[model samples]
Target chain A: MKRLIFCLAVLVLALAARPAPLFAQAGGPLRLEITEGVIEPMPIAVAPFLSGTANAGELAARISAVVVADLAGSGLFRAIPAEAQIAQVTSFDAPVRFADWKAINAQALVTGTVERTGADRVAVSFRLFDVFAGAPLGDGMRFEASEASWRRLAHKVADTVYQRLTGEPGYFDSRIAFVSETGPKNARRKRLALMDQDGANLRYLTGDMSIVLAPRFSPDGRQILYTSYESGLPRAYLLDLETLGQRPIDNQAGVATFAPRFSPDGLQVVYSLERGGNTDIHITSLVTGQTQRLTETPAIETAPDFSPDGRQIVFESDRSGTQQIYVMPAAGGPAQRISAGQGRYGTPVWSPRGDRIAFTKQQAGRFHIGVMRTDGTGERLLTASFLDEGPSWAPNGRLLIFTRVSQGEAGAPSLYTVDVTGRNLRAIATPDFASDPTWSPLLP
Target chain B: MPIRRSILTVAMLGLLAACGQNAPYGNTPPPGFGGGVPTDAVDVSVFGAGVTDTVLFPVDTWELTDAATATLTAQAAWFTRNPQATAVIEGHADERGTREYNIGLSARRANSVVEFLVLNGVAPSRLTTIPYGKDRPLEICSDEACYARNRRAVTVVAGSVDLGS
Candidate 1:
């Protein structure tokens, strides 16, 4: 029996080392497995965090609400309403009443506490329990941050709970950079904007003086790369978030450059340059300012994305007389077409896990947001609409957000998110029309 | 001489079409034609009157059709008549395509017009190009007619042009 248990432990470790599949459905008392079919949301109870200090009651409640909202919004967990709880968590260290939670059909229970740790500083701690097993699922943890960042603390706590249950990293603590649009479709004004993943902390990084498109976050999330028409022509610009300063990525006269994305290392930028009406992909070193042409075909080549390991680049091209997806070495070489199905494809974005590529396809008078394996197999269309394009992946590679424009005169573009399995389709709330959403890496 | 005669014939047809329709291109009448005082600087209205200032393209293509070529031929003649004027060609695409790809396609459309004008003896130094993609559409409908009107290149005569020069 001891040898058998040792073998099982080794097998679990080996599976963990491999890139996790679509869902981690490990056998556990509180497992919420998601298969190809309908997923029954797991019932979980998020007890309001206890306030350690007299003045922390309201903040503590708000934090708990955010945690509950995050889990419920994911569609994998069904948060039991606070009113439905049989008992309240009044203390942080007290043992959970497993029988009461089990009676309410809550497979998992979450409890936490909030306290004013210092001047303008707050501390949050949380613990997760398997109600059926009558034991804590993971060790309790605490996080400290500025009091103004209470929502982030809540996300971090929820992320910890999610990781412990799902065996996957949570994307709650990430941010998104997108374009906020206003005015008439004929003369719309666009500005770059950033917000937390849940649409909180909305802030505009650029004024509406110039049209901005496709704001992409660097791997470090401290800087943004986007296309702007400020110079009487479309060009790519790099904006530093800390200083709110921007500089053109390439400003050569008579050349229109746009669609810029940073390499995984954030040390190089890959973008398209239009010279005399020809668009091709080019990469420039940030440190050396040296630019190299990655593609030299007469056909249009744009929207280049680097793999997570920065070994290969996947981009869209029209060399085959129709738009299609192609993958090539990062150092520049012959590319192999990876999209073989009917219709046209563009805006190909490689998945963060390096297993799939998300793209926009147009066929038979309709547009679709789809994904395929790097080898071009397993093609699945996640969305079909009058106009849907530009798929940006979450840091965990489990979800995608793209733009969906309605049809006709009153049509406007909006941001929508969907799980990789094409489930849990939800629209992200923005103050104005939004598009080209790029998710930032998980916050440091 | 044959090109001049054809230009005159098309100019007459354009005037008839402008008078018989309610702005078929969806463009508001130029200042001088709409009862507003015309500025001394060359504008699209005066330069395009009786000669269309825009050329339309087929879907997802920048190749100049025969009608588009004829329109450019007329535009080149206008430039010759107003040698001191400069123009900025604006390229646009329909709403059916992606934003960045449309930008590229429109740029090609603008370049095609610029190349046509240069070949017709217009000075290359007097022209510039701006690809608007689908950001600006004259028609708001989602039908093919609206899309056809949106996919175009327009020669917007700049205010800096000195007619007296």
Candidate 2:
């Protein structure tokens, strides 16, 4: 028996010593996991693509520049300037000089080539390399689009590069709809404005004839639901982005409806309706024009937002004697309060990843922009100031854009974006004071 | 001559007292634009000018405070004097809370005012509530004083009396 036991022990030790066959380490490239929280931006070098034709050279350079900007704006990767590059990528299929990148301490290298496919058409092919591993990070890919869509093609390349490194979707191709404010502080003129996620290609969807508020995009990014005070009463209006056409909702004559948001499926809109001195959340189906009251409580219930899966809704309610965040079934049921902190939590928006909820909190006379787990744990305040309200999550769910107001009369609310980890707080440049920003999903 | 003048002055004073007693009050509609009161017109009286139109509330609470109740009580008296008048109660909040949540809070504040006025004999049908949240601010300052004024409910009267001013 002793001899048998010794043999079994030896077998077990040998099995442990050998690595698991299923967990075999592939020999290709070194990849880093881009987890939540702060870390030094990985240094990357994106070489200007070698154009297949002489006329495509300028277009190639422009595309490369856009890719650099998109990656830098993410606060995840720092692109080394062309002046810092030790080696030039003259050919698409040629091998990368790992030693040259190593000399510059670049962890990642990107090389691409562009070719003109037709009049107003182009094809962009790129590859990402792990400088240390001396191998391609993933399979190379090609994107084709019209020359007018060059910016979009560049955004696509950046998205793929970001996904290759971070293992997450990129929000570089998204858009935002916000209320643009100008004039004096009191009688400010506000119009609905839309722009690319990087604050380019700005377009005014509505004139300054009326006050617009809380413009939220549909899931497909083709339409927006906003509240306008055109009839001298706050009412919800649906605007089509492609046509720039709009119409008021069929709310009852005496009732005021506002704070509109699109349902996950974009088949209905959930908004607040004030009637007979009481405010309640009402869902109106776009197909049937049928309005259903979600909450009938005397306490005000507004700001209803849907979960990513459309199975649940997260909204704010004052039924508990104070403003608190709550989640309920999408079909309307008993709501569970998710915010337990002492502060007044409101404007609770569920993250696109369905992992967290972002909100604005007011406590002790100060306001803060914060995020919490879906179940109300792991609360983190990303920003605190005299005023920071109305947080809208980026399409990637990794960042939030909110309205931040300065102190005093001159302190108008401006658009600002912050990373989920409380770092990279930056202001989004707008021509005027902006507020109630809603980010669109990745463009088609 | 002194006795005749005293008699004429007493007669004039009696006539004035009778006119005051006969003025339209209670459930009777004022004799102006017939019985139909235009709902679209904005009447700034009952709660405007000499009368207090707005009652302020504390942060995050919709319950009427002592000061708010006092102002609304006077407002209720004005409503009593003008029974035919209808009102649109506009509720507002300061820039402290989320825009959507503040809408709810403002709705509650306006509802509280409506309830108090109803309990003080204002007809329920004569009031409509609209909550503007933090979208509309009476004072643009960011201090507590401005915020205090911002968190308010204003009763704008509407009736056949042509009280546009």
Clashing pairs in 1: none
Instruction: Quote the lDDT for A88 in model 2.
Output: 90
Off by over 4 Å in 1: A1-29, B1-42, B159-165
| Every model's DockQ | 0.33, 0.25
In the range B1-165, model 2's lDDT, one tens digit per residue, is 456434534543443343232222111222231233322233334354555677889877788889888888888887886676677677889877777667767877888999999999999999877777786777888888999988988886545332322
What is the alpha-carbon lDDT for the whole of candidate 2? 0.81
lDDT of 1 by residue, A1-444 (tens): 999999999988876664422222346545555544436677899988899887999999999999999998887789999999988888888778899999998878999899998999999998998887888887899999999899999999988888877777889999999999897776677899999999999999998866789989999999999998877788899999999999988757878899999999999999999987789999998888899999999888889999999999999888898888999999999999999899999999999988999999999999999999999999999999999999999988888999999998888999999989899999999999998899999998
Q: After best superposition, candidate 2 residue B51: deviation in angstroms?
A: 2.0
Tens-digit lDDT track of model 2 for A1-444: 999999999988876665321111267345445545235677889988879776999999999999999998888888999999989988899888899998998888889988999999999999998887777888999999998888888889999988887778898888899999986665567899999888888889987756679999999999999988676567899999999898876558877788888888999888888776577888889999998888878777888899999898888888888888999888788999999988888888999999999999989888999999999999999999988988999999989999998888887989999999888888999988899999999999
Docking quality of model 2: it rates as acceptable
